[model samples]
Target: MTGIASHPEIAATLALKRRGITLTLLTTAYFFSYMDRQILAILQELIRKDLLLSDTQLGLLAGFAFAIFYATLGIPVARLADRGNRVNIIAIALALWSLMTAVCGLAQNFAQLLAARIGVGVGEAGSSPPSHSIIADLYPPEKRAGAMGIYSLGVVLGTAFGTMIGGTVAHLYGWRVAMFTVGLPGIALAILVKLFVVEPPRGMSDAQIVAEGQDKGVIPPLGDGFRTMLASGPAFNLVMGVTITSLIGYGHAAFGPSFLQRSVGLSMIDVARYVAPVGAVCGTISAVGGGWLANKVAARYGLHAQAWLVLALKCIGLPLSFLFYASSNPYVAVPLYWVSLLFVSSYLGPSFALIQGLAPLRMRALWAAVTLLVINLVGLGLGPTAIGVISDLLRPAFGEDSLRYAMLTFAAATPWALWHYWRAGVLLKRAGA
Candidate 1:
C-alpha cells in the first residue's frame, strides 16, 4: 500500500521476477519428471539383454506398471494439493521420483525393477496436478496456454535429452549408469523448489482472490469436482482426444528406439548424436511457438479456434508419422519423425489451457488429475504394452520390422482422436467459449 503511492513499477518488476523464477523452477522439475519417466525408452534394449526380458515385460516396465500407479495416485494427491501447499507437494514429489529413478539402477530382477518404477510413478503422481493448479493461478485464462506451453517445453526437451543422454550413456557406460546419471540432479532441483517457489492463493488468476480469504468458495467434494470436470462437452472430448493421442504417442516413444536400431540400423550413439537433435529442435519450436500462435489465434477468433488448431495439427501429423516409420533412409526418416513430433505435440498447450479454463476454481487440480487418470491409465497403461505384445506376435514373420509395423497399427487409430477434437471444436464454438 505504501509502495503504491511512490514506486509501483518496482513492485510490478519484483512480481514479474517472482513469477518468472517460480515458473522456471516448476518447469525444471517437470523436465526431470519426464526425463526420469521416458529414459526407459532408450535403455530398454540393454535392460532386455541383461535381464533376459521380453519386449512385453519391458513395455510393462515402461508403461503399465508405472502408469497404473501414477494415474491412480494422482487424484488423491491432487485433492490434497487443491487445499495444501502445492509448492511443498511438488518439491517432495521431485525428490521422491529422482531418488526412485536412481534406485532403478539397483534392481537385480524384474520384480525389483517394477517396484522401483512403481515408486517413480507414485512420486510423479504428485507432480503435474499441483503444477497445473499453480500455473492456472499465476497466469489468467487468456495467457494460460502460452504459459502452459512454455511449461510444456519440459516434455519435449526432457524426452529429447532423455534419449540423447541415456542413449549415449547406455552405449558407453551401460543403462544402469545412465539411470543414475539422469536421476541424481533432480534432488538438488527439489531443494531449490522447496526453498524458492511460493504458493499463490487459489483462483488468483481468475480474479477471485479477496483479502478476507481467497474467497473462492468452499473447496468442493471429490464428487463435485468430478461433475464439474465432466459437465463440459469440450472437457470430455479434449481429454479423450489427448488420451487417444497418448495411446499412440507413448507406444511409439516406448519402441521408437528399437525400431530405429533394428529397422534403420542406427546405433544407440547415432540416435543420440543424429536423431535426438532433430526432435529437440523441432519439438522446442512446437512447444513454445504453438502456445504463442494459439494465443494470437484465440485473441482474434476466440477460444474455439484453439480446438481447430489441434485438429489441423493432428490431421497433418498422422500422415507424416506414417512416412517417418515406413521410410528406410535416415535423412528422410529422421526429418519426418521430428516433424511429426512437432505437429502432434503442438496440441498440448491449447488442449491443457482449455481444460484448465473450463475447470472450477476449487477443483482445478482434481480436474487435471482426473484428466491424467484416464489418459495415463488407458493410454500409457496400454499403448506401450500393446505395441510390445503386438511386436512379439509379429516377430515370427517380420523379425526386426515388427516394432515399426506395430507402431503403425497404433497410428492407424489416430483418426479417432481427430474426430474428438473436431467435436470439441464444434462444442466450444457453439457455447461461444
Candidate 2:
C-alpha cells in the first residue's frame, strides 16, 4: 500500500508495465547473447570437419575456454555495475560481443575461432549483473519471481532462434555466414538499448533497498556486499542448487545439436528447422508459465514464493528430464525436451527474484555477479565439458550411445538439485520468511 500510488490498480498496472519493458529488453539482449554463443554448435560438425579438431578439443573450445573469460570477468564488472552505470555497460558489452561473433565467421584456423569465442564470452560477462540490478530496481519483491521468469525467457527463446537460424543458414550458405548473420543484428540493438532504456532510481520497487543503503552515507564495498550474500544459509543453498541444475541444462543445450546430428541422424538444417523452433516455443511458455504459477502459489500460501516455486518446478522436472535424456525417438524426445526445459528454466525467474529481493540496493549487481560466478564456473564451465569428457570416456563401451548415457548421468543430478532447493526453502523459513 505504501509503495502503491493513489489509484491502487493503476500503481500495480504501472509496475507491471515497467517490469514488462525491462524484461523485454533483457530477454532480447539474452536472445542475441545465446545466438552468438551457440552459432558454433549448429556448425559443430562442419567446424570439426573443416578444422579437423577432435571432440576433446571441441569441448574445450565450447566449454572451458569460453567459460574462463565469461565467469572470471563477471565479478569485477558487477562491482562496476554496483558503483557505475549499468545500461552503459550493457550497451558496450553488446557491441563487443556482437562484433566478435561476426568475427567468428572470418576465422580460418582453430586459434582464431577460439579467440573470437573468447571475445564473445568476455563481452557477454558484462550483461547479467547489470541486468539483474536493473530488474531489482524495477519490480517489487512479490513480483520479482514472475518478472525474473519472464526475463529468463530470453534464454529459451534465444536458444531456439539461434539454433533455428544457425542450423538453417549454415545448411544453406555455410557456418561462417550464419555467425556473421546473427552477430550483426546485436550491434544495432546495442545502440537502441543505450539510447532508449533509462536506468531507474535504485530501490524504487522495494522498501528494503533503501534500508540497505541511502540511510547511511556509507556505501558498502563490493567485497562486503558479496560477503553478506555468502554469509546467508538460504543464499548459499539457492546458488548451489541452481548451479547444479544449470549443469544439466547447459550441457544438454550445448550437445543437443550434435546428438541430433549423430544419433537422430538429422542434418544441421533439420535440427534448426525442427528442434530449435520447438525448443523456443516450449521453453518460453514453460518459463513464463512457471513464474506465473510460482507467484500464484506463493501469494496464496503467504510463504517464500521463490523457494516454493523452485521446489515444485524442480521436483516435477527431475523425472521429466530423465525421460527427455533417455528417449531415442525424435518425436518423443522433442516434446519431452520442452517439459524438461520448462522445469529447469522455470527456476531462473524465482531464484533471481529471491536473490535480488534479499540483496541491498547497492549490491544488486554484485549479488548477481557472485551468483553468476558460481553458476557459470560450476554450471556452464563444467557442465558441457564434463559431459563431453564422460561421453568420450564411455565411447568405447557405449559406442555412439555414449552421449545418451552421459546425458542420463547428468539428468540423475536433478533430484539432487531438488534436494538443495528444499534445503534452501528450509533456510528461507529459518531466516524469518
Q: Where's the lowest-lDDT run of ten residues in candidate 1?
A: 1-10
lDDT of 1 by residue, 1-433 (tens): 2332145355334434579898899888988998899999888888998989998999899899999999999999998998777888999999999999999999998999999999999999999999999899789878999998999988888888999999998888999999999999999999999777767756667754434455546778899877877788999999999999888888998888888988888888888888987888898898888899889889999998898898887888989999988987887898899888878888888888999998878888999999999999989899999999999999999997888889889999999999999999899999998
Clashing pairs in 2: 149-349
Where in model 1 is the C-alpha error above 4 Å?
1-16, 208-215
User: Residue by residue across 1-433, what tens digits does model 2's lDDT show?
Assistant: 2334445455445545666665677779987898788777778889989999766667777787888899889989998887776778999999999999999999998899889989999999999999998888777877777878888887888878888888888888988899999999999999888765656655667666465666342458767876898898888888888889888888887888888777666678888887788678778888898778778876776446467678887787777777877777878877787667766678888788877877767788888989998888888888888888998899999888788888888887877778778888888777766
After aligning candidate 1 to the native by TM-score, how far in Å is the CA of 161 from where it should be? Answer: 0.6
Q: Name the candidate that leads on lDDT.
A: 1
For candidate 1, the lDDT comes to 0.88
- Candidate 2 TM-score versus the reference: 0.92
Model 2 ranges off by over 4 Å:
1-19, 208-217
CA lDDT of every candidate: 0.88, 0.80
